[model samples]
Target: MLLAAALLAAAALLARGLARIEGELARAAAAGNRPARVEFVVPEGSSARRGVPPRLAELGGGRALLGTPEGELVVLRRDPTSGELELERVYRLERDPERHLRREGAPLHGWFLTDVERERRTALREAWERYQSALAQALEDFGASLPTAEEAAAEVARRGGADRLLALTGPEASALQRRTAAIGLARAGYAGALPALLVLLRDHQRNAGFFARLCALTEELSGLALDPARPAEALAEAEAWLRAHPVRDPYARKGAASAGPVSPPR
Candidate 1:
């Protein structure tokens, strides 16, 4: 009886929180939204460089993204006929940024960073810096022992060794090497790799790229991206997924065709 009462209280609180969110959304929908004017930052030595820039339609008609006052990314559509840019078709109440890109390999061109997203990215950058710093310290301690980032990535893609890839992600390897291995595991789409990826995800050294790549692999492999915000829940869900899809190949049937196309966390 006590447990049931607690669950009911929790449900009521959730409903109230949701109601407040819905009210805010309704109020915001009634107001005008503005786009931010800022330059895009292409990460130094980053793999995904095809981000759509704002006013790309000025060069030619292309689908891009726009940041609005509402702190969300809205798809900017260009009319192929008139070469005019506008918001995507019929996006009134429903405005989930991920919905903007329906195609599997579509490039998310323009960056629309909200204050919240900026804060999040700043934190992520710091985490990456810390991770890289730790990696450099480890590298100084152990000189040139394991394979290079390019070599490790290539090896994992060429030969289906999930264990080898997992090892490369450990503390002994450089950040570049570790990122490449994680990207390889995701792009290779190996069923055996999925379990290892989940373990790595749970290991959770604030691996920002891993989360996005996990979305890519989960979607590509099972046609699903069931994200649980919390890491523990996400691991549980992945375990459930493994149980559901038992008969998958150990490696990519068609090698790493895509150069590790990553998507936003869903």
Candidate 2:
């Protein structure tokens, strides 16, 4: 009789556990299918309470019923007859934690969405247009040159064209254009253009040494004489510039080594 009683007790416990699991599943299904209102609490220093919706959607799947700039609330519904659960509408709640903290005189660190789609799109479009225009102009000038021009036309075409472009437009014209040409010449190992870039670097009126340094480093890596004159004055000036504003490019160290030790400006 004791053995039979023990077996019965074990079965009863098993049934209870199963029932509890079933109840939890039902609750989860209902929550997924039902509509809910949500409230979001944004952290301090956030530009906008915008990312919550997408993050919630990803976490909850398409079952998210409502989403607001502040937060999202979702409902889970279960079909009584079919024993199936579905997610209903989600409600978004908007609350700015930073604003609240500010009101309460609490310290808050600011947040900025650096990869915002709209801002990225605008930047890309502007860059594309500017570089395209510059490249078109350079090509046109190349076409205008005579078949048998002064100096090696092919070499000039290769090295002098970019320098000419930089001279005409000046380094301050467009950041995108300057960077694009700098990168292109750097990749091609064009050293002849370094002289023009150095001139820009020396020009106090144009604070474009950073761009020039990038170009110079590229040519330097190609085993070219960046400053052929090695004039004491120019060397001094280059050294002074380097001291004031160290070159950040990884390739610059190599350039510096190749150029020899430059004395600081007097």
Candidate 3:
């Protein structure tokens, strides 16, 4: 009777252990199936759905000041391993010179900056600076030098110069690289590169040439010279104008004539 009781108790303990193991396994499976919260950053002046910037991975730690199509400024932070970007904060960029200068100097990530948060923001700022430096180095290393006005024009005249620069506006290019490409495209007279430039400006407001080069390109591409002195107003006005006057294909209407039915031999 004692032996029989011992066997029954052992079986109960074993069943409990098995049940716990199964539960753990089920939880692990569920976690593995959950998708990573990765988001693609869209370019500034384009549709939110069009293109994903290549610089997304490099903009990790949510240090980037990203802009949505609606013109809202957002700070995004990402998990290093999971590559998931979570919204850390949002700020409405003020256009007024005094307000803009004041707000630009204030803490962007939070209402109040603790020592730890301050350190983090500083680190992020350093990272951005480093990335920008690296981008300039990369472009030079790639031999697409755009040092002066004359050099830029000559570079664009070279075979694949415009194409190579245009390619930099793709997902792989950094904000600085994209901005450089925008200038090159404008100099190349490639109007198609306008949207990419606009998107770059929208997505990265902190990037250099945000107002100067971008505004110039906008005017050249769209033929609507905006007031560059007021960057905020100019950006918004140019966006509105571009929306109203979309670049139609030079041959879209022409295709209709070719598609019509031909008469049979009579």
lDDT of 1: 0.47
TM-scores for all predictions: 0.32, 0.24, 0.34
Find the candidate with the highest TM-score and give its number. Answer: 3
- Compared with the true structure, all predictions reach lDDT values of 0.47, 0.38, 0.47
Quality of model 2 by C-alpha lDDT: 0.38
Order of candidates by TM-score, top first?
3, 1, 2
Of the two candidates 2 and 3, the one with more favorable lDDT, higher being better, is: 3
Assess the local accuracy of residue 104 in candidate 3 as a C-alpha lDDT between 0 and 100.
55
Any runs in candidate 1 off by more than 4 Å, and if so which? Answer: 1-152, 159-182, 205-209, 228-230, 252-266
The residue ranges of model 3 lying beyond 4 angstroms of the native Cα positions read 1-154, 157-161, 203-210, 248-266
lDDT of 1 by residue, 1-266 (tens): 22235446666764653343333333333343222233333333322244443121111124444433333455555466774445562221233457437767543653333344445556545544543454464367552422243333444454435556667666687555565566556566544445545655665525555564554555555445556455566667777877866634554333343535432222
Write one digit per residue (lDDT tens) for candidate 2, span 210-234: 4344334534533333442333444
Candidates' RMSD to native: 18.8, 22.2, 26.1
